[model samples]
Target: MKKLVVMGGGIGGVASAYELKQAVGSDHEIILVSDNPWFEFTPSNPWVAVNWRKPDAIRVDLDEAMSRRGIRFIHDPVVRVRPADDQLDLSSGTVLDYDMLVIATGPRLAFDEIEGLGPEGFTSSVCKTDHAAATAQVVEKLCEAPGPVVIGAAQGASCYGPAYEYAFILETELRRRKVRDRVPMTFVTPEPYIGHFGLDGVGDTKGLMESELRERHIKWLTNHRIDRVESGVMHVTGVKPDGSDAESSTLEFAHSMILPAFTGIDAVMGIDGLSNPRGFIPVDEFQRNPTYANVYAVGVCVAIPPVGKTPLPVGVPKTGFMIESMVTAAVGNIALALAGEEPRHRATWNALCLADFGDRGVAFLAVPQIPPRNTNWSSSGKWVHLAKVAIEKYYLHKVRKGTTEPFYEKFGMKLMGAGKLRGQA
Candidate 1:
């Protein structure tokens, strides 16, 4: 039996393993290696920080889930990836060889890039379950001594949805606690506009998000570069499009949560000719590593060039739907290879985001991913909240049951339209 090794047990990695199993059948051996034994649903992390959801609600046992699906699970961190020799060195001093490899290790949070940032410092983040728990404690304390609150993403940050979600959630929570007046909240982002979201700007997202922030009485600083964050102040620089100095605008906050930029995971980055300088793996349109046919990458681990530069750092966005498409294509190609037939590349991915606005939510769908594109659609409503909840539960169920249903087929069925369905069929 051929050995297929999947690095990382996150959403992308587990999804890929399930798809690989379906594509290659029971004859092939599949192994999933990761630092943690549980998979956390990242989208629910923002809610967890605000005490809306428990940690157990978003986390799942990876060993049990994968085991039922006939996939081997190894709970250990990978130290190095020798792509050329098809060997992976684990931190436990064990080496595993593979006939094929899938790098879905996800992004590494480079909090050290900014001095005095991260959990050790002035602010807290909701990016991880533990971090969110810590942030919850800090937020509870801040509620009593409410002053100024700053929430946003740092330079080169791509996943902007969570930042926006957290900010709005905090705003809503403050209002519910009848302490909205005591807290002065501000949003600081690397995006050129309030809703650029790393795709230049989605349909009506700029206007809609700006209006929402205004209605919520939330102030914002866009196109601003954060020089450093120390104590309770964040130093910023840049212009507000009218050519005015946005620099030296120090905003003091009692509590803050800034989403730092993301880079490729260390293990995947350590592989020579397998990753870009930024540590992101460069994959072909088929999601296969360009240099290594048997090697594939998906999700945040794949390298995508920036749409443009802002005063702060900017990065390309990779939503759940886009990652799903890449995983599907990778599985299709791998299946063909296993069947001794030529692999065909036919999957095209798009971005679909549902941004929660405390009480309501805004939904945006973009085709081709890059800006200046076609078939771009967007809408907003309170019903999105219900939809978001339903989907979250659906996802949890699917993960626990180890279902390999295409994510788009389940969540994005309406957005896919007849053209995509006919083509895939």
Candidate 2:
């Protein structure tokens, strides 16, 4: 029997595992290895950061969930990956052999790249459930003693939606507590424009986002990079389109949360033909590694180029829907490989995002996450916030049940009609 191993326990990893099992059935052995024991609904992290959702409420015990599906679960961290030998060494001195390896081990937050960044330093983060829970305490403290607030993504960061979500959500919470008037909020980012989002303003997102910021009385700095974050102060540099320095300034804040750039995890880093310079796995359209055909990757661990160039680096985001497509494509390719057939399936890489702002939210759909898409749409309303909440609960329930069905394809597509556009090309 063929042995397949999927790494990581995030959305992509769990989804891949469930899908792989369904595709291969009981004929092949399927194993899921994760550093953590719980599957976190990451999109709800902004809510967690503001105490709207508890950490336990958004997390699922992966050990129990995977057990019901007849899959072996390893809760140990992977220490190293030896692609040449098709082997993985775990931190607990255990080794695993696999005929096929699916990498869904999401990015390693690169907070260390910047001085005084991250929870260990001067700022807070909402990247993980624990991080969000801890940040909620900080948010409570901010409400108690209101002051300036800084919320944005660092240079080279790809995930801008959470940064925007946190900014607006926190603003909403502060306003609810009647402390917003005392807190002057500023959004700083590496995007060339207000809503570049690394994919370059989807469907007038620039206008909508800028308008939202203005309406909320929040200031912004685009094409800006944080040089260093000192306690209660942020050193920032502005960059011109020509890559020249535009301005250098320092802003003081009582609280801050900066989303750091992401890189591949340590286990897969520096593998000669498996990973790129940034430690991200380089995969073809079918989500199979070019050098190692037996290797496939999905989620934030996969390498995708930026949509275009900007003054500051802005990596493309692998949204939840896009990652779902990747997982489906990778699992299909693996099934074909088991049958001794060549890889053929390809992921559409389309993006559909719901950026919640507490009482209201923004939703966007890009036919193909890259620019020049057949369909590019974005809208904002209270419905979006409600939709995000519903999706979070539905997704968590789906994960617990080990359902391999594609949630976004089945629900989001019919809701937005973007799936019809995918049939065009």
User: Number of the top candidate by TM-score?
Assistant: 2
Per-residue CA lDDT of candidate 1, range 249-359, in tens? 788989899998999878877566799887999988778888888898878898988886565558988888888888888888888777887768655768878888668
Model 2 Cα lDDT, one tens digit per residue, 1-425: 98999999999999999999999967999999999999999999989999999999999999999999998899999989999999999999999999999999999999999999999999999999899999999999999999999999999999999999999999999999999999999999999999888899898799999999999999999999999999999999999999899999998999999999999999988989999989999999899999999999999999999998888999999998899999999999999999999889999898888889999988888888898998788888898899898999899999999998888877666665644335443
Clashing residue pairs in candidate 1 (N, C-alpha, C atoms within 3 angstroms): 156-313
Off by over 4 Å in 2: 417-425
Q: Which pairs of residues clash in candidate 2, taking residues 3 or more apart in a chain or in different chains?
A: none
Alpha carbon lDDT of residue 287, candidate 1? 84
lDDT of 1 at 260: 85
- Residue 85 CA error for candidate 2 (Å)? 0.6
* Candidate that scores best on lDDT: 2
Which stretches in model 1 have alpha-carbon errors above 4 Å?
239-246, 309-311, 415-425
Error of 1 at 234 (Å): 1.4
The 10 consecutive residues of candidate 2 with the worst lDDT sum are: 416-425
